[model samples]
Target: MKNLGKKIIIIFSLLATAIYANVVAKVYPKNVVSGEVATYTLTITGGEVNKPVISTICGSNVLGTSSQTSIQMINNDYKKSYVLSYQFMPQKNCVIAPVNVEVDGRMEQSNSVKVTVKPAVQDKNADFVVNLIPSKTKLFVGEPFNLQLVLKQKKDAEAVDSKFIAPDFKGFWVKGESQATRTEEGDFIITKAMYRLAPQREGNLTIQPAQLKIATRISSRDVWGGFMPQVKWKSYFSNEGHIKAKPLPNNAKIVGNFTISATADKLEINPNEAVNVTVKVVGDGNLEDIKSFKPYIPDVNVFDEKINIKGNTLTQKLAFVSDKDFTIPPFSLAFYNLKTKRVEKISTQPIHIKVNGAVKKTELKIQRDDSIKTSEKSLHVTQKREVLSKVWIVAAFVAGLLIGILIMLFVKPVKFLKKEKALNLNDEKLLLIKLLPYKDKDEEVKKIVDVLEANLYASKKEKIDKKILKEILKKYDIS
Candidate 1:
């Protein structure tokens, strides 16, 4: 009977332990800013537990999870527990969904938790501030200006590491300096960055805010084994602004203060030789807007080249060729000067060139005797006249007629007529067919066609540079 009582007592002890098993969940902070991480914890008591499986939480993402199990004897009583921790990033404010878990052999769920996320805000207690500044708030299209970003911090704040986010410059072309400078202003430390911006179009444009994330060490103290330093993190944002870009005047290709000058590589050259003419434009504005340049000189052929830019300077090279004396008419460029607040034209002086005449071909001749004296029939003995036979005469006439007919059909008459017509074609007519896809908007092409037409109909024949024309056609992708 006593043994049966001991068995009942053991069964009651097992039941009591099972009744005490339970699971609980907890979340820290309950509020955070976007991009900051939050944490969640799950604790299970009195039994073995499996890893918690969290359902999709609204407005937040789960980054990772970790777990630990432990047993201890406290006050002469045995105790066991299982714990799980989760880290997450919140996108916005929302209620976190209930988390699920399995403890021993039974399923359990935790109560839903609410989390709040706020937009980025300036910290009044922060040790630093960021400012974004522009040289000008209004500009003309194709005009250039400066943009600067400055970071100001307390002199005692040590910035161990930092991250910077620059604004997106839409509808504008931007170039940044390679180096940044840091300076001290009284009790503040300042770091500055600079960029050059050129407006690409005319309209209202917005410059987004710039952000800076900085990590700094504030203090240090001696610990158990070593000195421990305290670290703090802070983020700063700069104010955003708008810029207005106005359009340039019609036919005005440049917008800034600039000077233009041109020169020829040779003032005297052979008719078939070529000369390189270079035009340089130095300025503080956008040079890409000026696509091409043309000299308004007739008779001289001009082939333009791609523009080369070096810093604030733009250079264009042209190859000129001609068969007779000609002048490179004054070249002109129109631009709007912001300082003068008016449209101004810059021009280069006329260039006079002397082209040597075409070389004459000299024919080579071979000397030989035209007549030969024949022996007079062995010194006048029966000199029989070399009389042609009737059959021979007929054969000779037929051969001569066949040769004449063949020459008319293949050598002289038929092909010569077509060649004469081709030679009569004027320069403009030839270019029309050769330059199949002529761009009418291109000033250089239009000027070339005008000069060709003038030379064709004018009373005095104007020199034509066939070599330069061919080069121009080839440069424009013509066969």
Candidate 2:
């Protein structure tokens, strides 16, 4: 009976222990270096437990959180344990305050842990270092350049399992190439990457440091003449750099090395016909800056299609229409060339076209003359026949006049004159009125007219650009 009672008491004690929860706190790496990560774990055992909530820890920044659970059968009783971990980055040498947590509706506290943050460890015997190199440090806004991320290592070291972390390019546009090239020198091995970067903002810009995580193998000879090797992993960082981007003058937008050229499918065509014009730009810089290649020509219909970019080439296609022969003015683009260090201008050649008038009807005139002769001969016929012939001739004359009026309205007779009467355009205002197209109020036309008037009437005669007069005539649908 005594043994039976003792066994019952022990079983009850075990049950009571299992029914309650046990909690404790643990800190890893009591000593740490500044800027290093430290781990803190909260352990819970026995009965079921909710997740532990962590309190803020001083002198450290919480980086992340994680949790784990496990179950075991001990002495015919089920036991469970849970671990909640928090990762923190220590800023300096200081005492970490006690962390408070709640588990299973009970508040639990962890003991304070002291951390000795020492200076960062450096190895001067390192075999290699990573570098971020740029093609140029100074640039104008909207200018583009190349950047290289390189890992240069000594010949004695072998690099393996290399990983890279790129910097945050906040104010720049970056085009990155994925493949990394490996090259070997006489005493070094290099891994490199190429990238194209364009500054999106003006003023001072900084590129953050790049990181490289790599493992290297070193071989040594043992005392017994046998080779012993060891593999170690280390992280390397590249220096942070700055780029000075200057603002453009007069709000100039384009910057690069480029050439502009234009071509037309048909230079000459009838009125209301459309001609296809294609403009091409070939260069090594930002081709996307040329978003449009549309030129506004007076009295001509212009329709611009989408801009196409393939490789280093940019092409824009447009359709043009006019009612008379016209010369499309030369198109010019002004840009700063980084290589030449000067503002250069490129322009397309002027395009000229001829428009032919509608064909005239000579047969109608011949018919009218024959009808007049027949009427004159009718005088010798009988009186009844003469009367009928006279009526028919009058009717033909009226019909011909009506047809001529309709032709005049369709052909716009004023524009068909071979030469202008000087008396009709004695006033400069009259000349401008005749030259201005109803649909065009272009400033270029007005400026040309002013120059023409000054050259023809000013005290000092200046040579006027004859091309301007020719353009004005075509714009108004005049011959």
Candidate 3:
């Protein structure tokens, strides 16, 4: 009877605990700015609890999570609780839906929570500020422009470490340019980073705020009774930037001011030899917008090499091989010129090539020996002549074999016998052609090609060190 009573008491206690078990959800700092992290915590009490499965919090996946377990005894009754905390960064206002958690083998749902996220506000009076400045707010599609991220910090606020994060350029082709430049102003220091942006589509595109995280050095006492350096990090955000891109007229794909020029290594080549031509385009706009040039000629095999672009210049290498004379037909490129504010076309003149020593086909005719008759004496003379001809043929074959053996024994093999002409390393066009084959294979070779093209086509020529070029060629065993 006493055992039964104790079992009943234990059952009652379990029932009471199950009835009192509950889960609650809470979020601190219900309001926050975009790009700021928010914390959500779930508390479970009075029963065995399992880890909750939270897909997302405040419309963003949890960045990290942590849990805490606590136990207490009050008035001879034991109490236990579990708390799960999740961290997430919210980009906009959102509502966190209810999450289900298992407690004592039964599911329990927590109440929903709402968070208000506001756009980042720039504070001018703060110790540090970030600003995203665009060169132009309005431009045509495919037009190239500059975007600068400027950071200003007061002289008094010394940062021990700093990092900058750029926003996703959704509708633009972005290229990072030169390194950031630092300058000092009155009572503040300024740093600027430049990026080249070209719109991919026509629309009103929004660039999210850029973030700058900085850490300041501080002194803290360690357990060893010595002061240690500690850092406190803070993030500053730049304002959002908007760009209005308009469509180009006449379905033009390029927007820039450019000039096209072509040059060939030779206007005349031997039969089966290649005539190398380089077509270059140079100006101050989006050079990458230019497409590869395909020149068509009848009965000629044309090979287009990879296009090389450097700064405002673009170069394309081509080789034409044929046994007959052919003409490279003129081609044109149309682009919306920003300087002219109108559509303009640039074209290349037709190039004619002549092939030397081309083989020609000829018909051969044979006369029958039966058309003539000869006496016995004449026939005997003809037989003697045939025997002599056979002996001479055999003698010539043996002599030729002996000569070939003598030559092979004495002569050393010459590598690149066909390329006997010394390459002109000073000539940008020739150097570019030589280095192009190795461009994709080696990074240093690509840089050389870019420098060569820039020197050849860009308005501001890049200096080429012939010694350096020779060293690279020697590394590749290229003469």
What is the lDDT of every predicted structure here? 0.73, 0.73, 0.82
Worst 10 residues of 3 by lDDT: 362-371
lDDT of candidate 1 over 334-444, digit per residue (tens) = 888888888998899988888877444334332222111234434344333223355678899999999988888778555666643332335466665655457475655
Which pairs clash (backbone N, Cα, C closer than 3 Å) in model 1? none
Native-referenced Cα lDDT, model 1: 0.73
Off by over 4 Å in 1: 1-125, 175-179, 216-234, 249-253, 270-274, 294-305, 321-329, 352-479
| Tens digits of per-residue lDDT for model 2, 1-479 | 99999999999997775455366666677776444567777767746566655545554557889886777677898777777888876767767665555555776555566766655443435676777788989988878788888878888766777777786688886644547899998888888888788888789999876756677787876434579996555556677768999886656777888888989999778878898989999886666666687888877789999998776688989988887777877877788887777788899999986666723336988899999889877855667787899999999999999998888889866777757653343345565556555325767677766655675577545444557656766766554
- Each model's RMSD to truth, in Å? 29.2, 29.9, 34.2
Instruction: Give the Å shift of residue 210 in candidate 2.
Output: 1.4
RMSD of 1: 29.2
Q: Write the per-residue lDDT of candidate 3 for residues 1-479, one digit (tens) a residue.
A: 99999999999997776556477788866887677667899888755888877767765899989887877665798778888889888878878888888888988887788989877888877899989899999998888889988999899988889887787789887744769899999999999988888888899999888887788888987534589988766678988889999999878788888889999999998988999889998876666667789777778899998888877788999999999788998768888887777889889999988889866533332233332334556888999999999999999999999999888777865642456877777777777877899899988788888887777778557777778788888988886
Return the top candidate by TM-score. Answer: 3
TM-score of candidate 1 to 2 decimals:
0.48
Q: What lDDT is obtained when candidate 3 is compared to the true structure? A: 0.82
Instruction: Evaluate model 2: give its lDDT.
Output: 0.73
As a whole number from 0 to 100, the lDDT of residue 21 in candidate 3 is 49
lDDT top scorer: 3
Candidate scoring better on TM-score of 1 and 3:
3
TM of each candidate vs. truth: 0.48, 0.49, 0.59
